[model samples]
Target: MKVIHIAGWSGSGKTTFILKLCSHLVHRGRTATIKHIGSHYCALPLGKDTTLHFEAGADPAVGIDDEKTSAVFHGICLDDALNLLSDSGVRYAVLEGFKGMPFQKVHIGILDGPYLLKNPEVSEVLSVLDQFDDWYTPSGLMKELTDEYPGCHIFSWAGYVTDYQKTKDLCSRIEDEYGDDPLIAGIRARVHRWSDDGRYPVYLLMAMNNPFADAAIFFRAIQKIEVCTLS
Candidate 1:
């Protein structure tokens, strides 16, 4: 999933921008959003069913209606929230707040000055509140991998391989051998060069229905592949 954070100081139009972006993405494809309620006390009513459940120490109290379901998770971190979104199969996630966490950022109204200016992941800066169209384009917002995987059908595996050559050889071998296998389907490999550590991060995402089974088969075939420490 592609995740980006919209960050700015209080009243800098962070929420507005996030709402607009979410609307745009939902119109095109599946999208999920997370709002970081930093330090502020939640305004859930004093005596509501969900609020009472929370007070009774039921973590992640949930309430469902005909049209929508709302969940309240106490003390849930950003990563945990992201994991939930991923499990729900959201294509994109827009995070509002959590300015300290290191993820891609979209800044509004320039509150952090030089800090945001130097951050490599700060993709765009919008000085004007109404300039949403200028900053956001649904087609260009995220990296396009369609040329590599045409249907946008992909399953990612981020793990360590021996080296670049070994990674290439394994990908080539997989394509030659299991590319036609019904479970294996079309195997396309993209070696992500950027890594926090020196270990090679090889992604073997493909077009397949049973991704887990196919991934197991693919990894078993490549003896040099190792599970990555980072997700």
Candidate 2:
């Protein structure tokens, strides 16, 4: 799914802009989900079963009714949430206030910074939707990998990255460090240069004989790569 991030200071009409954007998308028969990232704490329903379950150490406490479902999660990061939304098959994932996120941004006010658009109308955003970045889950990455490098057994992978150069350098390091090992086989990387804005999203995958133990090492190696992202 394409990712759109709306960023601005308080009172910049961000919520109104997002509302208009989502409404327009809905009218056009598009599916979208919005995530609001706020600094202040939002209180849950007092004495509710879900809240009680959450307080009692459930990472994500879910409640279901005839009309809808509610979930309260603890310590869930933005990427995790986005992954969840992407898995739900939304066409557009709009981020309300994550200014620091790496994706292309639509700023609501004129400010001293770089953004895709300055106080753009919903139509303007739609005109340049192809310039936005894409998000990927592990399954998505594996699908891409399988399509590109058939016959290579990629048991595990890490992805949804934006920095191609850094990831390439890290992959080279991983090759030098572990390529000769018999356990880790067919280490592969894909740098997707499809974004109209010149950003490269990358994916790295490998087949491991011992998935549980080797995946830990693979992720630790991935963490050493310093990432620089586009706004």
Q: Pick out the ten consecutive residues of candidate 2 with the lowest summed lDDT.
A: 222-231
- The number of the candidate with the highest TM-score is 2
> On residues 1-231, what C-alpha lDDT tens digit does candidate 1 reach at each position?
556567788898777777766766776456888887776866888899999998888888999989999888886766567657755556677777888866646667765632333222212333322222111121221223334445444554555654656666666776677677777545555444334566655655555566555566656544434422221
How many clashes does the backbone of model 2 have? Answer: 0
**Poorly placed runs, candidate 2 (over 4 Å):** 27-39, 140-231
What tens digits encode model 2's per-residue C-alpha lDDT throughout 1-231?
A: 678888888888988999888887775434566556576777998998889899999978889999998878896478778767655655578888767666789999755567898898899999998899877555555654455556555665444456666665666776677667776765644455445565655656676656666776667555554342332
Candidate 1: give the clashing pairs: none
Best by lDDT: 2
> What's the lDDT of the predicted structure labeled candidate 1?
0.58
Give the RMSD in angstroms, all C-alphas superposed, for model 1.
8.7
